[model samples]
Target: MSNIIEIKNITKEFKVLNRREGLKGSLKDLFSRDYKIVRAVDNISMNITQGEIVGYLGPNGAGKSTTIKMMTGILEPTSGEILVDGCIPYKNRTRNAQNIGVVFGQRTQLWWALPLVESFKILKDIYGVTDKDYKDMLELYQSLVDIEPLLHKPVRQMSLGQRTLSDILAAFLHNPKIVFLDEPTIGLDVSMKAKIRTLIHALNKEKNTTVILTTHDMGDVDALCRRIVIIDKGKMLYDNDIEHLKGFFGYYRTLKIRVSGSLSETAEKIAAEFPEFSVSANDEWISVLVDEAKSTVMDVLSQLQKTYKIRDMQLEEISTEEVIKKIYEEGVK
Candidate 1:
């Protein structure tokens, strides 16, 4: 597939008024303006292909939102270029809108007083969707979302999950080539989040819809996105497949093993032999940090099984969220 979105050395800068102290500063600001320039998005670039789900991530005040706004044509960039399906979004917003969809979880595009179906009707008109196409799209989404019953309900009366799902459905109603979902599952229950993730995956898999998802939820990234672009302080930190990101810190994995026979005796011997590994035991569970570079989990487990009866074991790799947090706190060297 070809590149559906291309961002080349993009930057967005804002000028904020500098004010003095208290009422004096407030009143002086009306007559004279002293402004400071802030770079919300520094020079950053990435390419996304068709039928790909890319996670655009960053901490608060990072350039993630500014980049999204530029891509969706909501804000013009300070410099560089952005092409969505070969058209500059800010330059050809109306034409570009026809080929793309957007869903902001914290905000709603649907009319508050209007029934869900009515809002869709307005969108259908705005997009110039054909009767056959609209019906077919609704049918496809209904199978994935089970939103048929909520079609006639007022958007204001619906729960957050219902409204978010409705927003997702509306985004894909026109069968756009690309969709931008910003925090689509925020503030949702576990079940509802799963449902929404399923819906998003189905849209990308069944219809080949390209997706750009910006979220703090690692689960959403894990479930739907294979490739991710992480940014901080308006700069790109990492852009690669999920596995590659994980591999950056894949040298160690935490192992929690439950041993039934002679807990204290087994723990003492295990710790004695593998003093190089950080080993500890508490409540019949042996916790060890297995260094993948030096020793494997299988090697550790095999040694333990021979010494004691090992009932069960659970291995956990460093979570994606934790890795991202580390990058945000300390520069990814």
Candidate 2:
């Protein structure tokens, strides 16, 4: 497959004024030469193949937003190169806008007072979609989502999930080659998240639209992304499929145990016993994050049994959420 988005050694820096407190200081700060250059995105490179749904994972302040803005023509990179469908996003802003769509959470492109259908018509005209193409787009949406009931509802009147769905629909109304969705399911319930995930998957398969999703919701990553890119401290850390990423810490495991004693005391004892592993306790269970390189699961279990009786225990592989957490705290070696 051809690469739809190519970013090479891209870097973005912002000049922020160090404003001093109080009006006297604030006035002088306006003319103050003191400024700090914050490198929001370091030298990072990735090529996204056409029709791929990539989860751009990162903690806040990790440059995910800056990277996306550069890709969408909203912000220019300070250094390096980016090409979205063969056009430099910052240099050819107008042309770039035509080839891509974006939906930021809580930011509706649809008119607040206008019906959803009216919004679709407005977007169709804005994108210069032909009559046949507009009709075809609606057909595609219908096949994937039940958009009829939402057609007459005004954007302001829709619920959170409904409005989010509408925003995504509006973004895809013109059938752009690529779509960027930021926190699309941030605050949605499980049912709506599932619905939106299904809608996005169906649309991607049917329309072959390349998707770039940035979200903290693990469920979104698990459902929509075959590939994921992880970044931290303004630098790219890991880029691969979920299964492949898991291999980085394959020896990692989570052991949950129920003991016939105080959870906190049990937790403290376990922590002291294996200072290398992470140990925590809730109301009913004492959970430990074990790195087998430091100690095997059986070795940790036997040591735990020496102190307190193990009532119930379950050992499981590290989860996607835990993997992400680990990567954020300590980047993959």
Candidate 3:
């Protein structure tokens, strides 16, 4: 696939007033000219392919929003280049806007007092979308989310999940080639979140829409993205496939087993057998650190069952948050 979004060594800096502490300092600040340059995004570069769902992630204050704003032409970068589709986003915002869609979870683009469908009609007129195109787009979106009931509901009266769902539909109404989704599932119920994820997945699959999803939700990343570009302190830390990122953190998984009795001896024997694994035992409960590449969970259980009566066994993969936490702690090693 061709690269639809290319950002090369982009840097975005902002100048803010440097206010001093205390009443005296505050008085001085009224007459004094003090400023500081903050680099929200510093020398970050990434390429997102057409039809690829890329998770653009970072902790709070990690410049994730800055980068997205630059990409969407909301903020111009301090230096370097950003190419979305074929044009520089800031230079050709109108064209870029036509080619791409955006959804910010905390904000709504719909008219507060207008019926949801009325908002859609206004957008259709603004975008100059043909009636047939609007119908087709609505059909595709309706298949994923039941927007029929929402059509007549006033935006202000809609629930958070309902309003968010409407916002998502608005974003894709124009059938843009690329979409930028920022915390699209934030504050949503579990079922609503699942519904949104399923809709996003279907949109990507059917339309081959390029997506750059900025979110802290790991489940969102795992369910919708294959590749992840992680940033920290305004710098690109890790940009690779999800599995590769996991491997970079080393094999981190836990296998727990319950034996009838005397778990200490079993734990020791297992630890000795797999010297690399860290093992612990508390009564009948035993936990082992496992690298699936080296030994399968079933293999460990099979070996243990040979002597001890296996009461139960369970396997758990390292959570996505833990993987990101390690990245933040280690800093792109």
Give the candidate number with the greatest TM-score.
Answer: 2
TM-score of model 2 vs. true structure: 0.95
Candidate 3 residue spans exceeding 4 A from truth: 256-313
Give the local distance difference test score of model 1: 0.89
lDDT (Cα, 0-100) at 21 in candidate 3: 97
Tens digits of per-residue lDDT, candidate 3, 1-333, equal 788999999999999889999999999999987889999999999888899999999989999999999999989999999999879999999999998989989899899999999999999998889999999998887787778999999999999999988998898888888999999999999999999999999989988999889998998998999999988889988888898877775777888898875678878878887797778888567998777778877787787788778788878788777789878777875
Model 3 earns a TM-score of 0.84
Per-model TM-score, in order, reads 0.84, 0.95, 0.84
**Native-to-model Cα distance after best TM-score fit, residue 34 in candidate 2, in Å:** 1.2
Q: Which candidate number maximizes lDDT?
A: 2
Model 2, which residues run further than 4 Å from truth?
A: none
Name the lDDT value of residue 275 in candidate 3. Answer: 92
Candidate 2 residue lDDT tens string, 190-289: 9999999999898899889999999999889999899999998889999999888776876788899999968898789889978888899886999998
Q: State in Å the error of residue 59, model 1.
A: 0.7
Model 1 clashing residue pairs (backbone):
none
Minimal lDDT window, size 10, model 2: 242-251
Which pairs in model 3 have colliding backbones?
A: none
Pull out the clashing pairs in model 2: none
Error of 1 at 166 (Å): 0.4
